[model samples]
Target: MAQAAREPDFRTRLQEWIPKLVLSPSVAAMVVFVYGFIAFTVYLSFSDSRMLPSYDLVGFGNYAKLWGLSAWWTAIVNLGIFASLYIVTCTAIGLVLAIFLDQKIRGEGMLRPIYLYPMALSFIVTGTAWKWIMDPGIGIENSMHLWGWTSFEFDWIKDRNMAIYTVVIAAVWQTSGFVMAMFLAGLRGIDNEILKAAQIDGASSWSLYRRIVIPLLRPAFLSAFVILAHLAVKSYDLIVALTGGGPGRATELPATFMYSYTFTRNSMGIGAASAVIMLMTIAAIMTPYLYAELKEKT
Candidate 1:
């Protein structure tokens, strides 16, 4: 009997450890590739490396020079515009779509997919498609002219002063559907009793949303902001695909700036510094949300 009990105990212990053993390799890889590389990049930011990695430490000098560069400042300002407009437009459009869909409208399933289809495509595809559509020679402008609307001019993609807004437009189109889904889920989760209670209290539709429903959706709002802000900061591929940092430095964001300096310009130290700044920016946005989530769980 003692032998039988020992056999079952051993089996149970083995079962408990099997999942951990399976996961150990992935965890180790993440530590080495993700976190290990991050540490190395941070170290490089402080070194005198150029064109390649060097171990000679130079303190914060790289950071100082990085800030002094006009290109870096241009990227920062462009990011400000792009991030602000991208976040606001996506949120607004998403909220409106969510509210519209929550009314139990006909063909709901069909409409939801139609709205979300853009998100299914890769950013590269969206950017390339929009680029063709916005190009004056063979895109909308040409099509309009062919249709005899000679006065129809929509060549903003080639205009330096208006180029950054084109990036905003493409980014918003790709992301708004995702934000809408988040909000729709939030809306669906709201208690119908609460909405009915407000309705019975003589509250108008606008008043109900303004005073109660919107406030209750605070979690969704916070989540949307965090996700959008993170995306805005790290946005790279879309800009590269759409504008290629533009007719000039008009749409050059920090990510592009970092790549240009680090790899192309042989200013690896500056690039590393810029990369660290980007990492810090993401951390700053993420840290608060994480703390709040952990605190709430506890």
Candidate 2:
């Protein structure tokens, strides 16, 4: 009887301890891999690090230098342009494609693969193919001239003013198809009966789709927007393959800037500062949509 009275206290202790025991491995791994490494990076960011990771305390001296750097400033401004164009173009084109394909048209099976196959390939392939096709030496530009159009100059890749748009073209090619797939799945899940009822009420196709279909796909649009935002903010590979921040750094983006600072320049402190700044920027940009998404989820 006395042991039974003591059981309650033991059980309470056991319940409290079980969670720690259960979480021990994951916690350990996160500390070692995530938090530990992040802390080390942050520490390095404060010191005057170099080729071999110097540890002399320099306070925020590197950040002061970073803030004044023209390249960094250019990269920040250019990144904003890249991301805005990417998000807007991808979302608009993807939505249009998705709505068109939702008509249940014939040949969709074959066309779908052709449209989406670009996504299966790496950005390396996308960049290379696009670069070649737009190559000034022997691409569509020359091909167009070959076809008797004497003055067809499609060479934005080399233009300082318009190079970033070329990168966005490649990005949209890869990402828009994926967005279309997302919206198509959302469309399929929607009720056809609602459309039929709308039709019975003498609703025009434009009004029915606009007033009904678009509103219902809010979840899909919101989801796509969040994803596109994330991708745009951190986009690196395609830009590297396409331009390498080229034509006198006209296409320099935040990701490429971070890499150049960290690896090429051996400025670890500055690099970390850039990375943390990028994190803050991404969080700021995506927080509103993310909050709405979470509210919906809960």
All models: lDDT? 0.95, 0.86
* Highest TM-score against the true fold, candidate: 1
TM-score of 1: 0.93
Best by lDDT: 1
* Tens-digit per-residue lDDT, 184-264, candidate 2: 888898999999999999999999989999899988888888898888878888878888888789899888998998999
**Residue-level error in angstroms, candidate 2, position 71:** 0.9
Expressed as tens digits, the lDDT of each residue in 1-298 for candidate 1 is 9999899999999999999999999999999999999999999999999999999999999999999999999999999999999999999999999999999899989989988999889889999999999999999999999999999989888998889999999999999999999999999999999999989999999999999989999999999999999999999998899989987888999999999999999999999999999999999999999999999999
Q: Model 1 Cα displacement at 23 (Å)?
A: 3.3
What is the number of backbone collisions in each predicted candidate, taken in the order shown? 0, 0
Candidate 1: lDDT over CA atoms?
0.95
